[model samples]
Target: MKSACATKYEQIEEPDMANIVDAVLEHEADDRPAIVGETRTTSYRDLVDLARRLTGGLRQRFRNDEDVCLVVSHPGLEESLALTLAGWSLGHRVAVLPPYLKSRELEYALEQCSPVVTVSDQTPDSAGSVAFRTLLDAPASDLGSSASEAWLETFTSGTTGHSKCVDRRVSRLSDDIEQLASAMGLSADDKVTAMTTALSTTSVLPALLAGSTVVTIPLQTARQFWKAISDTSITVISGTPYAYEFAGRKKPEPGQLKNVRMALTTSARLRPDTARRFMEDTGVSIRNIMCSSESGHIAYNSSTDEELLAASVGKTLPGVTVEVRDDAGKVLPVGQSGRICIKSPYTATGYRNDPDSSAAVFQGDWVVSTDVGYLDAQGFLYLTGRDDHKIHFGAAKLDPQELEDILLSHPAVDDVLVVGEAHVRLGQIPVAQVVTSRETEAAELLAYCREQISATKVPQRIEFVDKITKDFKGQPVRPKYVRFD
Candidate 1:
């Protein structure tokens, strides 16, 4: 019996399979802003010329088959984008390293991909690396087609452990660009505010392919973020829940974000309160998007309803099918919570050089996500938590996200993480590390949790911290908590 997930990639004939650079070069006469940075803007013509020069530089430094890793030290820069497009144009596999990874994490990434050439903002301590600026000095080189199987290698967030390198082909990316652009209603006149890092290529690439000018902003602070949106006349924006949480802190003036038609959130879950508050202040709806590194864009909340946004991750996108399955892989009925498995044309082939992990997750055409979720009767998907994150407390299983979400709803709480702590009596008990506002007391927080959730779900120990450490994906880094003797 054939799996319902199995679907062939719809073949679309085009002059170029590598869409980004090809589109820019072909539309050089169009002379519109392709990339807008903090200090300057790159017109489509300029972008094409820059890519040509960079391709020449890359060709001089490395062979066509060699892999190149882009470590984006400086976020929202045109250099990173140029180098990436150039590598694709030259038929070399390009790996984009996450911008927020620490030194140790970066070392791990280098070991995993082991690219022949690394383009970075800072001088890499490792051999066979060059500064990004040097690429601009190279003379223009002859343009070439992408390699037949050339891939864009992206690493997982490594929050759980070491990141895995997921290799997605250029053809797959090209197909996704069209699908996403059509779904998002992107057009040539739109100005997209790219709040995500360079690693989030889908966020920026789809907009670029739609002929929209991408306005890059440093999402370091709320003030800077709002100012950028206001100044750039941004029509669309994509970011994580953490960015919106920061935005919720400041009240925007009337019509400040009026130009923004859609505000998309991904990477981390967005709390209902955070969405409602943001909508109240900015008059823009916060749409939660559920996606993965392996599978491109899976589901999105298309509706502007705040209540729906808070409850569900929205309906699956066109050409994407989602199913909930039990432990034995039998499909579960709607509203029955189980593992969330996705079947999509845009799913990546497999992980690069990690067959064991690939075989574990990717079964035939379906990418069996580690996330646990359920589907409503209306086809709306509600993510419960990660399957691995479930805590076995006595005989009762508890999801930490549920407790964390309840705690996050409190007015004084800034951020919170709930993890299992070893207990002699119960085997493991829930413990919460919270970052709160100045006035929020530990006792008050505990009382609030007691009021919200069941006794078993409540944290056995509550410790207040200055801030919660997060990985590149804005997910809480699980800490090695002190064991109670």
Candidate 2:
């Protein structure tokens, strides 16, 4: 399942205020389909006009030129993109939101952005919120006259903790789109399936802007996902490793995804088992692309080389540089794991309104990642775990990723999460919440772990679960594994 590696790099040009709106302007008169949704289809021509109308609607309704929050609740809907581009056309910073947020989570995001306007299929929590349909039906007006650059705000996956906003400008987004597509070797004719990330800068933008047809489908099961690929003749796919596991389990028909030439997995680590199994079933090796909300994409792994994909996300994508530095800002020598920092042409300005947090992560053109990994001799980035989520067992802090990788080797173990819980004597003790496909006991897993890792790193308690649920970003919800204590 080895694929083509990134062989070219290019300088990112700062596009004018077109943001996303300018993407389809070339086909304004041509009726070629640009976005294929589950419920509707938007031709390149209609996409432009609809977004223009929405732009007029935004101006007529809420004239604030700052930020607008778009709740992308409906899957495969054209209006979400239309409204985003619509907002950008007016020099408005558009913050795209996931639909799965609880009331409290949604409130936090809304409060931070304080968007002048909000649009969603559901009633948004913001003050000036309006129905998506209303915005879509508004009379078309000329694109906004403001020359201010539009911004894009995305949230961190928050798999191990809370989510934060990553505010980047549209000019940066344009360059990011080019680098990501080049890394994946995506082309204008490459039909792409965006099950969850139809609006994300990484997936849809590359194809949509390049005039490649983008297919959006409801992410219910692999059956439906594969069907969309077959129906639309999808040639490229981007999603999380969590979703790809299902596609492999369902097993596609022989040559069903023959049109799908490549795929990219992000958000969380792509387990070797998941990647190889999918490759075996579908002949499509999953390349684990390292991406961040603050920075669009940093690395690309095109090959399924066992040692490479298992340890490293990949080498740096085109026009991207990954540097490893120590706590005092000294560049660590190669192979020495430390802070994973990325430098590229396009990057988030910072986390919105959180100056302290923003200062820590967004340092000039570099996005200082909390991830801990090192570059191999050949320049591949190997991400071990987050710097913050170490399991502290009486001052002997352990990376959960290392421990989980050991538990994953078990025959019956399907998935595992290791976390530290407060204990009177140990200060904190390791607890393992494991997902299994067949019969297994905590005692058996404990014994298996003892054989692989040291006892201090082993889970003191093991809890069995049916499955590990993921958030909207397809990140596993790494809650404290709450105990009644």
Query: Candidate 2 clash total?
Result: 0
For candidate 1, what is the lDDT?
Answer: 0.71
- Say which candidate scores most in TM-score: 1
Worst 10 residues of 1 by lDDT: 1-10
Provide the overall lDDT of each model, using Cα atoms, as 2-decimal numbers.
0.71, 0.68
lDDT, candidate 2, 1-485, per-residue tens: 00011011123454343334555676678687888777777888888788788877777776564445544444335777777777776777777665544454456667666554557777644467777676666788775432346777676633111456667767667767766666677766777777663475667787776778888755677787787778889888877655675566588776678788887777666666666667777777677878777777788887658556655688887668889999898999988978889877666777766777877776766778877788878888887656666554542445677668778989998888777776543445778889998998889999987776555567889989877777899766664322211
Model 2: how far is 453 from its true place, Å?
36
Clash pairs of candidate 1?
none
TM-score, cand. 1: 0.74
Best by lDDT: 1
Compute the lDDT of residue 56 as modeled in candidate 2.
72
Q: Tell me the spans in candidate 1 whose CA falls farther than 4 Å from its real position.
A: 1-18, 67-76, 98-102, 124-127, 158-161, 389-485
